[model samples]
Target: MTDVSKIFAPGGVLSQTIDGFQPRPAQQQMASAIAAMNDDAGVLVVEAETGTGKTFAYLAPALLAKTDDGERKKVIVSTGTKNLQEQLFHRDLPRIRDALAPDAIVALLKGRSNYLCIQRMDQFISQPIKHDPAVALQLQQQSRVVKYWANQTRSGDLGELTELAEDAIILPQITSTADNCLGRDCPAYADCYLVKARQEALEADVVVVNHHLFFADAVLKDTGFGELIPHADLVIFDEAHQVPDIASQYFSESISTRQLQDLAQDMRLLYGTELKDLRQLSTVADQLDKCGRDLRLQFARDPERGNWREQMRRAQVIEDSERLADTLDRAQAIAKAALGRNKVLDQCYERLVLLKARWQQLTNTQRSGYSFWYETTPRQLSVHQTPLSVAEKFTSYMLAQQMQWVFTSATLAVNGSFKHFTDRLGLGSAQTLVLPSPFDFAKQAMLFLPRYLPAASDPTMAASFAAIAKQLIAHNHGGTFLLFTSYRMLNQVAAILQEQESSDRLILVQGRTSKRELLDQFVDAGDAILLGTSSFWEGVDVRGDALRLVMIDKLPFAAPDDPLLQARIEDCRLRGQNPFQDVQIPQAVISLKQGAGRLIRDALDTGVLVVCDNRLVQKEYGQTFLASLPAMSRTRDIAQVTEFLSKD
Candidate 1:
């Protein structure tokens, strides 16, 4: 018998480690499949439902894979978020190793920015105030706190500074970036914290990373950190549904007005003593800043949400963008003439050169298989050139690396088809497995489709959603997540709930506070209604009766105006396909699956999933969305839903 079956048997290690652990057939099956995978099998795509113990199911077999000489095989376990990476590294992996593989070594690696650069921090502290003394004074105060921690910390991770909050202005100045890092030439190269972390990852038996970092290393080649994929024997992706979007973002070319301004500011600071030519350089910086401001205003004239590709072709827009690029080129020449062999100045000059290159790329008409667009943020404007499709390149990358892959997530399939996901990654021929959750969903949960509501796009839909949500909260006595697709809807529904004459129930809305604070309030209130949007849709877990209902305001579809989505839609149309059915509907189906999964976390947990959009029941594709959900009891009867919630 295999080690997998022996360890997963009735009286095995897991049962002993976890209290009252029942042997799950689904878990055992998944472990066996993972144990059986070889290089010849290529990739394995597994859709393990919510309660299937997926983390352990894969981790157990991965831990057991070893050479006959008893050397541990190197493995990379990549998750979709840093929270899960922390959980796996600090919590789950240790417990599993203690119970199973006692000698195993595991390391958690995050992006370079997550760690403090001792060199950068020291330089920041020693430098005289050149710009903004108020900001300088704040950094000086914070550096004292950081200095003490830097001496005591082995990891140099910023996460250890509990007193410092995430939004602290002091962080960006102290952290290292690829553009700013001097690499081997830095004075503190021997003691660099980020270099030490990478060394540890290189030697560890198992490495934990988030998807963003993994994709960066896999494709972007120059993510500052060296290659990780070529060194791994196997790569496992948890929450694999998020890979396509992250890949799209990492592979694209982006340059922003903020980036240009930062380069200019850094150039100003890199020079130590004031040169006689300082006034000339300062004037050039100011002119470039004005040009950036003008470019921002030009983009803001059209507030339409999506790609501004056509707008970029406008004669005035083209002239202005070229002028902005020219101003920067002139500024670069002035700086090169003023500054000597200073390393800091060299790095800043390189950034200026790169920015110019991106501008040339953005405005050039020769590039095919790419979408050129511009977007505006509250503080700045940006330009992007994204590939119309990354499928071919991604597939070639995976094959070139020659590492066997395992991709698992609860939300990978739509209407029992894996084509939506597989095609996106160009893995149509990979081995596939669908393991349903062992939870008795028919008894443990119910799908409630509220009938006869306003269209999801209607302005008054928020009021109707609030009315239904209010009734459900009254019936269930709280622990509800009122999820909206848009911030406008979220705010409107929140206001309506506030104005309604109902019994006092704690209501926590997103953006009112930090996400951590909101979740803490929700869990502590125990009977509170949490109003949120996209970020709250997934990666949230509230087990048992504390989260008894998940009320989604509409079908979770990507906005038609999103630049990336629009590009994908046009690509599909040009190929003579139904973009709505093949692309849009499948994508939304997967999102709905993720949102509905917040409930029924454990075998005994129960709840009701309420989708307020009547289109889910009226549209022809409604059944496609409905079929992708767990096989739970379904109904439109309000009384039935009320009774289910009212149960003890």
Candidate 2:
């Protein structure tokens, strides 16, 4: 911090307002790592504790290197959630700039989904309406957000627009895509938000982007990473666990029917009242409509409403998606040759070709447990297929990178070893380090497992859950987070507690409200209980003792039904590896860490994380769960938990 202190000395490079926010030791180490990496390049893994000022550790280096004028260099920081992305862009990043270089330029970048494409919005608004209130609310909300965009938004990034529904159609409405962007020639080109945001990021010294977009830039669409990396000196990945997954997504292929429909809709909209393009576009749309109807007529149920694999009639649907994209690609060539220099026509043609190419890739690509499939309902549709084993490719990307690579999270190591995740990402011999949290976890938190609770297979798991919820929460009777892996289990837990015991206060479930709203209620609980899923796992913060008990129903394993997991596991087996040990357990360890992390959010936060699964004692893998967690004191006794809460 002496170096940081000098930087803040009288008329120092860093400004006066940020003088008080000196670098903590962890922050300095992070900064030092980035600085060293500017000239050096093995790999760095940082385990920054919560109060360790990790944000500043990386941000300061990105800022300092920019002091030299006109180099066109930057640092890319990727976080895991939109909330964290927002916090950094709107809060932390600005504070660091004020403390270090008040005049520095910065910007936040997100995926296309988070921005509004006014051209797309106009098309949706003009179309015939849907009757659902949520749908209506989403459309109306999109209009309001775009209205906000014209003035307060320069880049038109929706993260700048604070108020909107999570499911709003408006967000998807406004963002540009490879399918719809007319480049510099579209009617909305001057007003295009996505392009504008990217333009600004190209000029800014520090760019705050998410892992998805960062990896997408680095791999899938090489042009995106090219915009900054050619000039960038360093890159920081926060919530780095998500990096491997994001990298895999970009390096691999995905194509969907919904992708076709969206592009088709855009073409029709751009074509407008012109009867020729409409006739052509509508022909494609009608074909897709028939595909949906055929699948529905055969299955008699929407694939999305339940298990899609049960709908054996999808072979035709998959074939049709490929045929449609290919047919459109041919039509696009004719249109491009005939239309010649017309900007809108050229864009429509390019979009048609791109859509077709992606769809073709989806249909042809084959991997273990993978198939060309469509997820469809009368109202919703997505057509895509994904490969099971992306680990080989993910590891190659990491190993190939020339920059200093750091992967850190609260739970990277399972059972006192980082091998699980390291091996999964293909990091064979990379240097690894571990830092047990400085927090006296045993003194600040406790682990409670109900010995009497029935096993997952027991017919009375719900009843056992209610008894456990009552025991842990009834004593404190204020704030608690009941975490479950599934809506079925969450609903069961909700029913058990709501029907069997009376809290006489608000009990909010995940579906009833957004995760953000639920966390708010939990924080402000007069006697509030929040029931949430993995979305609530890591990003949540309920400080002090307001949040007292975090009851988990099962150790979160990848949903056994997920096509992605099924595909990956099969690929692992072909290589003669234990999928349970290599894939499932590591994935679950990260999730458990996220859920268990809900308890000790702040240094002062005092709560008990009750694992309803007694397997912590029964299963060998349970030891991994215990070791990955903060070093909290443990006990299976209910009496000890009750006694601990008595201090309140």
* TM-score top scorer: 1
Q: Weakest 10 consecutive residues, lDDT, candidate 2?
A: 222-231
Q: Which pairs of residues collide in candidate 1?
A: none
| Consecutive 10-residue window with the lowest summed lDDT within model 1 | 221-230
Clashing pairs in 2: 116-174, 117-174, 117-175, 256-383, 257-383, 442-633
For candidate 1, lDDT tens digit of each residue in 423-445? Answer: 87889898899999999989999
Q: After superposition, which runs of candidate 2 have C-alpha atoms over 4 Å from their true positions?
A: 1-31, 38-40, 65-73, 118-145, 148-152, 160-163, 170-172, 222-231, 267-272, 275-281, 292-337, 365-374, 391-401
Root-mean-square deviation per candidate: 2.5, 4.3
Relative to the true structure, how large is the alpha-carbon lDDT of every model? 0.82, 0.67
lDDT of 2: 0.67
Which of the numbered candidates is closest to the native, going by highest lDDT? 1
List model 2 lDDT by residue over 1-648, tens digit each.
Answer: 225534534554544466455434455555566555534345666666565566766677667763235553466777887778888889888877876667778887777767777776665667644548977875675686667565666666566566665655665665666555555555676777777777777778778887777776666453222332223556677887776666655655655446555655655544454446446655655555455444345434545533334343467656655556556665575556657545556666766666667656655544334533445566555545555556677666555665556666665777777666666567666566554454667888889877866787687887788777887677875588888887788888788777766657678888886676777776776467888877877777677777878888888888776655665677778779998988888888888887887777655767787888978879988887887777789998999998887666
The TM-score obtained by model 2 is 0.86
